[model samples]
Target: MISHSSTAHPMPNSVVNLYVYDQSIAGVAKMPLDDFATAFGVPKESINLNSPELRRYFLNHIQIITEAKPWQTHIESVRVINSNDPIVREYQELLLNFICTPVKRTSTRDFTFKYDAIIHQVITHKIMVNVVQDWQGGILGSQVQVGEIALNIPKGQYFPLVVKLQNGSWWKGFGSMVSLGMYHIAEGADHLLFLLVLLLPCMLVPNGQNWGAFASASFGIKHMVKLVTAFTLGHSITLFVGAFQWIRLPQQWVEVWIALSIMISSIHAYRPLFAKKEGWIALGFGFVHGMAFASILMDIRLSAGALAWSILGFNLGIECMQILLLTVVLPLILWLSKRSEYILFRKVVSAISFLIACFWMLERIFFFKQL
Candidate 1:
C-alpha cells in the first residue's frame, strides 16, 4: 500500500486517465494463506488511486475467456445470420468484447477535486473513461510500475505538465532546442536547394544575358553576406510570432511554396530571372519558411520564458549550420565559377534540383505520404 508519509506523488494531475491493475498473489500456486499475508502484508490496491479513508468496498477479480468455452457456445446459436440481424450484432459484440473485468466504484473522497482549478483549462472536451482488468501467469507484487505508453503526437511524445507558468522559471534545455533546429534545417531539402542555387551565382557577374567571373571576390562575398543576413531576419520574425501563437498558417501550403521557390531559382540558373535581386527573393520567401519552422515549436506547445530561450537556441543552431554549410560550399562555388566545365556542372545540378523541386511540389500538393 502507498504510505501516507510518502512525499512523491505517483504522477502529475495532468494525466487524464489512471489505470490500476491487481495481480494474483498465488497465481494457482499451492501456497499457504500465511505466506500470502507475509509477502503482501498490506494490499497495494487497499489505498486505491486516491485517499484511503473511505468505507466503500471494492472487489479484486479476473475472468477467463477461451475459444472452446465461449466461441463454441456462441457459434452454436448462429443460423443464417445477416448484417442487419439482431443475433449477428450480439455475436459480434461478444467476439469483440474481450474485456474480462469491469470497474465499478463509488467513494466520497474525490481525488479529481485536486485538479478542479486547472482541469477546465486543459480538458476542453469530453473524454470517455473505460475500465479494464487482466490476469497474469506469474507471482505479482504489491508495488505498481508504469508500463508502455502511446501518445497521439508527431515526432515524439510530449508530456503535458500543469505548470504554474506565471511564477515558475522556464527549463533550460538549450542543447535540445538547438538539436531540433539543426535536424530540421538539415532535412529540409527544398529549403537548402533554394538557398544554395541562389548562392551559386553570387560570384558570377550578370552581363545582360550571360554569366562571367566576378569583378572582385569582395563584391561577391558582400552580396552573399547581405542575402544570408536578409534570409535570417525574414525567418526569425515569423518563427517568434508563430511560437507565441500570434500567427498561424497551413503546413501543406508552406511546403508547396518552398518547393516552388527552389524550382524558380533552379530555372534562373539556366536563365536569369531575378538577376541581382536574389537578396530580395530570399527575404520574401523566407517568411513562408519561418512559418514552417514555427509549426514545429507550436505543435509541442512551448510558451513564455521557455519559448524565448528555445527560440534563441534554435535560431542560433540554424545560423551555425548555415555558416558551416556556406564556409564549405561558397569557396568551392567561387573556384568553379571561373572554370568553363563548372557551367556544365552548374546546369546539370540545376536541372536535377528543378526536377526534384517539381516532384516535391506535386507531392506536397497531393499530400503524398512519404515512406
Candidate 2:
C-alpha cells in the first residue's frame, strides 16, 4: 500500500508511505540470516526488516513524475508494524517511508506515481494508493482512496497511475488551524481554570494581609485588561518562537508548569499572594501555557508559509475563545463581588481550582514517569 501527504520539512516535498507484507518483501532484499536459515528456519521473533540494498531497490523502482520530470525519491526510514486482524490473526508489515521532492517547487500538488517495488517481481501483488493528509484540501487524520496500481493481466504491463488531488489553498489550511486552536482551548479545562482563577480576585483590593473590599468597576476592568493582555503577549511570543523551534522544552515539564501556574493563581485568588502584581505573574505563567500550545503546532506538517499562517490563525482562535469566556463570566464575577457571600464563593472556587491543579500535576508527573 502507498499513501501521500505534505511533509513537515522546510523544503516542500511529498511524504509517501509504502507498506509491504514482511513475508512478501523478504524476496526483495538479502536477509541477515544464513542461507539455510533463510530457506528453512522458522521466523524469528525479531529481525532487521530494511537495509541499504532494500532502500536502493525502492529508490530505483518508485518514481513520482510531475510537470513531465521525475521527482527525486529517497528512503527516510523503515520500521515494522503490527497490523493484526482482530477477528482473524496477528501479523506484521514493513513500513517504508519515502520522501519525494519535486524538481520544480511549483509542482507539489499533482503527480503521477510509478511504483514497481515488489510488484515488479511479484506480479500477483497489488498496491493500494491513498491520500492520508492534504491540509489545503481539508483532509486531516483520515484516508481517502486515490486508486490502485496493478498489472493489466490482458496487456501484461503495469500502467502509471496519475493522482489528481483537490486543489488546495492557503485560506483553507489557515481556517482549519483556527478551528483547531479554538477546540484545543475549549477542551483544555486546566488552561481555562488557570485564567479564571487568576481573574477571581481582580475586583477585590488587598488590605493588610487579606482581600479587602470590592474595588471600583473601572479599576477592575483596567486591571483585568492588563492581566489578559500581558498573558496574550507572553504566550504569543513563545508560540511563535517555539513553533519555529528556536526554543524547546519537554512536554511533561510544560504540563507540570501549566498545572503549577493554575495552583499559584488559585492560591492568589484565595488570599493576596502577589496582590497587585498579577499582570506580571500572568505574563510569566502565560509563557508556560504558550509552551503547551506550541506542542500542538509541532505535530503538524507545514511549509514555512503554512506554519506562519497556522500560528496566526491558531492564536486568533485562542483569543476569540478567551474573549467569549470572559464576556460570559466577567459580569457575573463583578456582580458577585458586591455580595457578602462573594468571599465564601471565591474561597470555594479557589480551593477547587487548587485541588484540580494539584491532581493534574500529579497525574502528569506519574504518567510521564511510567512512560
Candidate 3:
C-alpha cells in the first residue's frame, strides 16, 4: 500500500467511510442545549452565529444531509464493529454501551416515548453543512476542518482520510476506489511475473530434459483457460469473503505465500511441479493473492449498500485489466512457443521470475522497515 505520508508529494485520496454509527431515532438530531435552549424556537442571545456555543449547536443540527433514496431503509441494528485494534475495539465498546441502553427523559409535549439514544440515527451516510474558515479565523461556509492530515501514516494501519461529505456523490466515491484497485493490480510486478512464467509452458510439453513441440491451438487455449479459471475462482472466493469480514488472515503470511507461489510456479515451468494438476496449485496460491487483493477493502468501512457496490466495481476493474493483459500477451506467447528456441526462452523467463520472487519474499519479510 502506498502511504500518502512517506513521499514529499501529496497523493490525496478522498476516501470517506462509515465507521461510527449514531444510535438514535425520530430524525431530530440534537443540538447542544447551550446553543438553543428552546426545542421549537431560537433564543435571543444564542442567535449570534459567531457565538462558540451556537457554532457547536448548528454543527449537530445539520440533518439528513445525505440525499436518501425512497427504497433505502434505516432499520439496521446498531451494533459495535469488531476489530483487533485496541483503540477501535474500545471505541466500539464504549459507543455501544453509551447508545444502546434506553434513556427516559420527561417531556411536557404529548410524546409517549422518550429518546433512547442521545446520538443521531445510524444510516448509510451523514449530511453536514460545509463549515469553511476565513483568512482571519472567522467561519466561512459555516464549516470547520475536523482533523489534521499529518504526513506520517503508521504501517499496519489505514492511512487517515479526512473528507467532508458536503457535496460528494456516491458513484464518484465508488469510481475512485475502483481506480485504486486497478492501479494496485497493474503495479503488482510479482503477480504479473508469476502469471507470465506459468503461462509459457502451457503451450509446450516435456520432451526428455527440454520442452517438446507446441501444443495444438485448441489445447493451448483450453489449457490457458483452465489455469485462468481456476485462478479466478480461487482468488474471487477469498477476495469477497475477506472483504466482507468473514475471515481474516495475517497480511505478512499472505504476502510470504504469494512470493512462494511465484517462485514455485517459475520452477514448475522448467520441470513440472504438479503436472496436469497445475490448476490446483494455481487455485491454492490464488487464494493468497486474493487475500492480498482484499487488503484495500479492509481499510475503509462502508455501509452495506456502498460496500456491495465497491466490491462489484473493484472486482470488475481488476478482472477486466487481467483479461485485457492476457488477451494481448497470450497470443504472443503462443507464437513464440511454436519455435524450437522457445524452450530456452521459457527457461530464461522462469529463471528471471524465480530470482524476482525470491527478492519479493525477502522484501515482504522486512515489511515494517520499508515504505
Question: Which candidate has the top score in lDDT?
Answer: 2
Name the candidate that leads on TM-score. 2
C-alpha lDDT of all candidate models, in order:
0.52, 0.73, 0.55
What 10-residue stretch in candidate 2 is worst by lDDT?
A: 21-30
Per-residue lDDT tens digits for candidate 1, residues 91-141, read 111101111221232211111211111222222211112111111111012
TM-score per candidate: 0.56, 0.76, 0.58
10 residues in a row with least lDDT, candidate 1: 70-79
**lDDT for residue 93 in candidate 2, whole number 0-100:** 51
| Pick by TM-score: 1 or 2, better one | 2
Q: TM-score for candidate 3, please give it.
A: 0.58
lDDT of 1: 0.52
Q: Give the CA lDDT, 0 to 100, for residue 66 in model 1.
A: 28
How do all the candidates rank in terms of TM-score, highest first? 2, 3, 1
The deviation in Å at residue 325 for candidate 3 is 0.9
